[model samples]
Target: MLQSFYLILCILGFVLPYSQFVPFLLEHGLDIKLFFEQLFANRISGFFGMDVAVSSLVLWTFVFWEGTRLKMRYLWVYVVCNLLVGVSFGLPLFLLIRQRQVEQQTD
Candidate 1:
């Protein structure tokens, strides 16, 4: 049940953000300056952007520390997911994988 939830979240995470971003990409064609300008265009957006930035750093740290402790391979997968999507995809994906590994160890 939990894994299913995480999988759903992963799909939603990838889809929802790209839903917004893909159109931007289509219209702008990799406008980095415009992207940042719009991202921090207002106080609320800036707040969210900063928060996500900090959260991504924290997520990366957690992925490294906990994943290494559990001896999980392919730690890069989560990071790549994060880079491609966002923390929404990466964190739950990591949690789902971690849960399976824990269950395996107990079994």
Candidate 2:
């Protein structure tokens, strides 16, 4: 349940900014290249891409864990694949968010 909520939140973080704010900026005549360069230099793209990746991982992890718990042997392959995807794309974002949550709770 908590994992699901986190996954949704992470996805929203990515979608909202891109779909809402990015389009608004573009409609207002923002230069695409300059916008991208600024975004890249400040690491915003990396941050948001990581957010999406981590959310995907969290969602898949929950799925695989549940499948395994249910004795679904066929899902082992899926688990491996999901883990690979997560590590390739989601690990950094996962770590970042996990660390943030830990810090917030500790504080």
Which candidate wins on lDDT? 1
> What is the per-residue lDDT of model 1 for residues 40-107, given as tens digits with 9 covering 90 to 100?
99999999999999999999999999999999999999999998889988999999999898888889
TM-score of each: 0.96, 0.29
Off by over 4 Å in 1: none
Candidate 2 lDDT score relative to the true structure: 0.53
Top candidate when judged by TM-score against the true structure: 1
State the RMSD for candidate 2.
11.1
Candidate 1 structure lDDT: 0.93
Give per-residue CA lDDT, model 2, range 1-107, as digits (tens).
45555566556544544575567576766676865565466577868656756766675675456544444445444335334443332433343445455556579
Q: For each candidate in turn, give its C-alpha RMSD to the true structure in angstroms.
A: 0.7, 11.1
TM-score of model number 2? 0.29
